[model samples]
Each structure stands twice: as structure tokens, then as C-alpha cells.
Target: MKIIIGSLNPTKVGAVKKVFNQYKVEGLNVPSNVSNQPLTDQETMQGAINRAYNARIAGESEIGIGLEGGVIIENDRLFLCNWGALVYENEVILASGAKILLPSEFINELRNGTELSVLMEQYTNEKDIRSKEGAVGVFTNGRITRTEIFEHICELLFGQYEFKKRKEENN
Candidate 1:
């Protein structure tokens, strides 16, 4: 099986490779067609779906994966959100990772129009933080790296596909 990922970011690409070890996987830059910082779950999921389909079309592969990280405010508290999508032909499956409340300091910066990636880089003083451990890694203190987070979501997405396939076969 051939799999294509929407973003060339190491974190995302690494997650796909780790999850679909049996498949040939490649990552390419693809547009999400969403805000730099998606503030809602709907926008975040749409971004993932968009990237999945676009990457499938671009790579001409059997499966395409898209991972998107965003933030949402609930009860005036900001939470880190990550979503993943898998695209096969006209079908799509999605799964989201655990959400954690972000620090108030980071929320202030996010409210000030700074993207999460930019805020993370500034907070960590590391260039290309997204390519490495990402905000998930920082918040979890490396307990759960970004690649692992996305890999879990990818597994969930693929599991859903497998369940659907089995159901269809039984029917």
C-alpha cells in the first residue's frame, strides 16, 4: 500500500510512517485552506480533510493522511487540539487526539493573533519546533511527542476504516 501525507513536517510524517509501517509513505506540502491558527473544531477538522484529499490527489496514492493542530477556547480556557484524517478515494475518516488546556500565558499570545507554532517556537526558543516535538511534546514534558499523538489518532482513523470494511464484508 502507498500512503501520502499532507505535510512534510517531520512530526506528522513520522507519525504516518510509524503507524503504517507496512506501507510506502511519503510526505508533501499541501494547503489546508484554513486559518493559520484554527480556533474551532470545525475549522480544524475541515483543514485535515482538505489536506487529506489534496494529498491523495497530488500523490496518486491509495491512501492519504492529514494531520492538523489547532486550539479551541472553552469556558475562557484554551485547549490544545489535534485532528487527523484519512482519505481513500471519496471516503474519509477522522480522529482527534486528547486535548489539554494550555497555559494562560500562551493563551494570551494566541489571542493576540500569534499562531501556535510561532508561540511554541518563541516559548521554547527553538527553531522549527513543529518539525520536532511540538506543543504536545512540551505540554506533556516529552511524555507524548507530537508524532506519537498523531500516530494514535491515525491508528484510530485506520481502525474505523477496518471496522467499516469488515462490516461491509459481513453484510
Candidate 2:
């Protein structure tokens, strides 16, 4: 199947391609000029949906995927969260992360409208928003990059394919 990923982040593209390659899914990167304006959990998912929908309208691919992330506050705590969406032949699959906690100060900063990327930049001093190597980098460590966060979200949305394959083998 021809799948288009809606983002220009290299880490996200690479991670999605790595997993999709195992299933023999031909993946293509479709960069979106859309704004990265995700301030809340709902808005984050909206960003992904917008990207995926835009990609589908812009291409002939059989599938389009979008990944978006943001920080959300709950129970007096700040959490790093993500959402993913898949659009294919009129079907849409969406999924999100289970809240991951952040530092108290970071939490306060985020609630003030500071984007996660900027927070990461000031905390890590790396100045690269896609590396996931700064403050939040600890979550991914060396196992995955920041860009992979979106890829991971996509995996959560599409991972059922692997589960189905496993079930078929047992049958």
C-alpha cells in the first residue's frame, strides 16, 4: 500500500518508515505547510487530523498519516501527550498517549502558553526541536528521537495490523 506521512520531521518519517517497512508498506513523506499550533490535547489531535486530511487531498496515496503532540494539564500536573490519525479510503483511525508527567517548573511554563519545543530548547540548550534530546529527551533517551514521538503515536493507531497478523498465524 502507498502511505503518505504528513510531516517534514526526519525522525518521525524515519521511525514510521522503519516499522512500515516490515509490513512491506511503501511509505512516502508528505510535508504539510500547516501551523504547528497545538496548545491543548484536543488541539494537538486536531493538528494531526488537519495534516492527514490535507495530505490526502494533495496526493494520490492510498493512506495518509499525521502525528501531533502537546502538553496537557490534569490533576494539578503537566503531562506530555501525543495524538495520531490515519486516513485511508475514507476511514479514519485516531489514537493518543496516556499522560506522561513533566517537571513542576516545566509544567508551569507549559501552562503559560509556551510551546513544548521552546521549553525543550531552553531546558536542553540543544536548540533542535526534533531531537527529543533535551529535557523531554529523557523519555526517549537513545532508544528514540523526539520526532519518533509522532511515529510512536502512529504506531499506536496502526499497530493493530501486527496484532491481526499474529492472530492469523495462530489460526
Candidate 3:
């Protein structure tokens, strides 16, 4: 089957590749149509959905995968969140990664309307932290990478798709 991943970001592409290695996969820069730093879980997931649908149509492929990272608030505390989606034919599967709580200082910065990527870049004195180890990797002390976070989500997407197929066939 042909697979397309939405986003030219190396980490997102790498995450999908780890799961769909047996298939013909292509990575294309597709618009998510969401803010660069999505502020809520819903918007983040919407980005993933939009990317997946757009990529599938753009590549004329059987499957499309999208991954997105964002920040969310729970009980007035900001946390890092990521979401992923897989689209196939008339079906779509969605999965989310673990949420890592942000430090209070970063939360304050975000509340002041700074984008997460920009804040992270300044914090680490690094460039393109969003496309690299990511906030998850830094916050997690390099134990879990951005790629691994989305990789697990991609695995969940395929697992859900397979489970749905089996259920339909059995029915």
C-alpha cells in the first residue's frame, strides 16, 4: 500500500517511517491550517486530521499519516501535548502521545503569548528544538524523544485500523 506522511519535518517523517517501513512511504510538506503553536488539545488534534486528509489527497495514496505537537492547559497548568492521525479510504484513526507538564516559567512565557517553539528555543539556547529533541525530549531528560512520542502514536493508529478491519471482516 502507498502511504503519505504530512509534514517535511524530519521528526514527524521519521516517526511515521518507523511504523510504515514495509510500505512505500513519502513525506510531503502539507498545510495543517492551524496555528504554529496550537493552544489547545482540540486544535492540535485538528491539525493532525487536516494534515492526514490533505496528504492522502495530495499524494493519491492509500494511507496518510499526520503528527502534530502543541501545548494544552489542565487545571490552569500548561502541558506539552502531541497528537497523530491516520486516514484510509472512508476511515480515520486518531491517537495521542503522553503529556509532559511544562515548567512554571515556561508556562508563564506561554501565557504571555510566546509560541512554545520560540520559548523552547530560547530556553535551550538552541535552534529548531521543535524539529529536534523537542520539549518532550528535553523535559524527559533525553529519555524519550519527539520521534518516539509520535512513533508510538503512529503504532496506535495502525493498530486501531487493523482492529477495525478485523472487526468489520468478522461482522
The prediction achieving the highest lDDT against the true structure is 3
Give candidate 3 regions above 4 Å deviation.
Answer: 111-113
RMSD in angstroms between candidate 1 and the native structure over all alpha carbons: 1.3
lDDT preference between candidates 1 and 3, better one: 3
lDDT digits (tens) for residues 1-171 of candidate 1: 889999999889998888888889999999999988988888899999989998999999999888999999777788888999999967899999999888767776777789999988888889887888888889889998888889999899889988988998999
Better of 2 and 3 by lDDT: 3
**What is model 3's C-alpha RMSD?**
1.4
C-alpha lDDT (0 to 100) for residue 122 of candidate 3: 87
Q: For model 3, what is the error of residue 105's alpha carbon versus the real structure, in angstroms, after optimal superposition?
A: 2.4
- Alpha-carbon shift of residue 171 in model 3 (angstroms): 4.0
- lDDT score, residue 140, model 3? 93
lDDT of 2 by residue, 14-69 (tens): 65687576543333455433345354688777877776777666656767777766
Please state the error at residue 146 of candidate 1 in Å: 0.6
Question: Global lDDT of each model?
Answer: 0.89, 0.65, 0.90
Note the clash tally of each candidate.
Answer: 0, 0, 0
